[model samples]
Target: MNSKKSKYHLLVLMDLSKASEAALKNAVHLAKEINGKVEVFHVKSPADVAKYENQFSAMRAIQEDTSNVQSKLMKLIREIEKEEKVVITLQISYGNAKQAIKDKIDSVKPDLVILGKRKNNLMNFLEPDITKFVLKECNANILISGEDNKFHSFDDISLGVYGETIHKEGLEIISDLKTNEEDPIRFFRIRNPNNSDKSVTTEQNKKWAVSYTFSEGENALDGLASYITGTNTQLFCIPRKQNENASWFGLSRINDLIYKLNIPVLILR
Candidate 1:
């Protein structure tokens, strides 16, 4: 195992929406617990500014507009900094939200990136694409949050394990988290009935807090969804196995559940 001090710097994507607000709060909670700094990021499109240029002075409006948003965020950052003494910074950029974030990820090199799940039903089809884009592009760890996830400590962590071989990377990442000895870590062995491996029983021998369940045929994704919901899992981890079926981590049913889970899904590569 690699040994090094763990230092966390978080970058949270915020558009000032309700869902973004929730994502920011969750990021703050984690930062406070870890004594880490946070960067509140916002992206604007040039076309958006041009659309309103005729009505308002472009330069003045842009500065005033960004300042208004920054002022509110800075106020919140100050309060959190004063109360928890954690450092927080604001970053604003122009262009596509997804691309802007990717660039920021390269420049800032954040340990973890927190993004809000799209809450608009009308744009449901488009939202998952952005999530998939980020998952594929960003190299650092990711935490996807929905509006329902409020500011709370991560007391329970659930690791969705396919079998023994594929989840070793995830275990390594989990070992690095700043977790107390008593914090419960649940290892969920999601078995496929067709496969006779049944590694769950063998895995149980290695850990005390292990749970096993088989995926219901055709309804496997729903079954796992219900499991996460019942567990009220604070942080859910899954492996992003490459060249796998959609069930593994592709842009399909599992992707759908990733957005619907309402909790942070930490993708482990």
Candidate 2:
């Protein structure tokens, strides 16, 4: 998918939280940059509607709640359309938040799906992690907006390669974004201590100057986390698909980095 030549259709899951707001802003920024379209989506669960059903007289509480949310979302969409000069769409779904979002993704066929992380997540067993669930199930590319970090551009893009094959599709993703030619990109290739190689490479492409940094560490996720700690990366592009086994670091380790890194992660398929 040539993101630059293609008209991007971005779908953002707006929960009205600060993190979701950031995701919406980022999506709008990207859409304005590439002359794309934005779809702001929200989901309501039946249980939530039932809680407020009695408050309303006759109508299905869910319907009333949906109408109210639709109005607020429309207001937001209009503001964004006027400010960004981009076509914006509003969508609302009812039922389980996860299933509703998955269905929307299938129906919309958006180029990118934007999600936000919860702040101070308490890890309640009852509250399903929508972001993780969607990432695992959805087939489209995803942009997870970290609650602890906010970014407006992908000027400093970082790629973490942990003994895994680098795919051309990943590079295509960068090309599609149409990032600036002067933007700096760092590729960290992590290896174990015994296999460490201090050699570095610099390659100049049509749009970016890619620099390679070799680091030694036993745990791939930990090494990436350490590199992130000492760098000011606006985005992290990782080449891992959904439901596949976490090759280098365990699945739990990947989750740890996603939660702790506190930066936007672009999962490349």
In terms of TM-score, which candidate is strongest?
1
Candidate 1 wrong stretches, greater than 4 Å: 1-6, 52-56, 118-128, 155-173, 176-184, 189-192, 198-205, 242-248
lDDT of 1 at 205: 30
| Model 2, runs deviating above 4 Å | 1-6, 51-59, 120-127, 148-151, 155-166, 181-184, 192-223, 241-246
Clashing pairs in 1: none
Model 1, residue 233: distance off in Å is 2.7
Q: How well does candidate 1 score on lDDT at residue 267?
A: 66
Q: For model 2, how does the per-residue alpha-carbon lDDT over 1-269 read when each residue is reduced to its tens digit?
A: 12354477789888766667778878887666555677888887767667653656424777777888888777777876787666677877777787788888998888788876666451221235776676678887787776653547643344433223335655555665645556545555454446535433222352343444444345555656767656766666666632122444444555666776666777665
Candidate 2: C-alpha lDDT: 0.63
TM-score of each: 0.78, 0.77
TM-score of 1: 0.78
For model 2, where is the 10-residue window of minimal lDDT? 200-209
> What digit string (tens of lDDT, one per residue) describes model 1 on residues 1-269?
11233367789877766667767777877765554567888777766665563655766677777788788877777876686655667987777767887898998888788877655321121233666777788887777775474675653344444333335544544654525435445545455456565433222234434554655466666777777678766676665653223355454644676756766677665
Alpha carbon lDDT at 126, candidate 2: 20
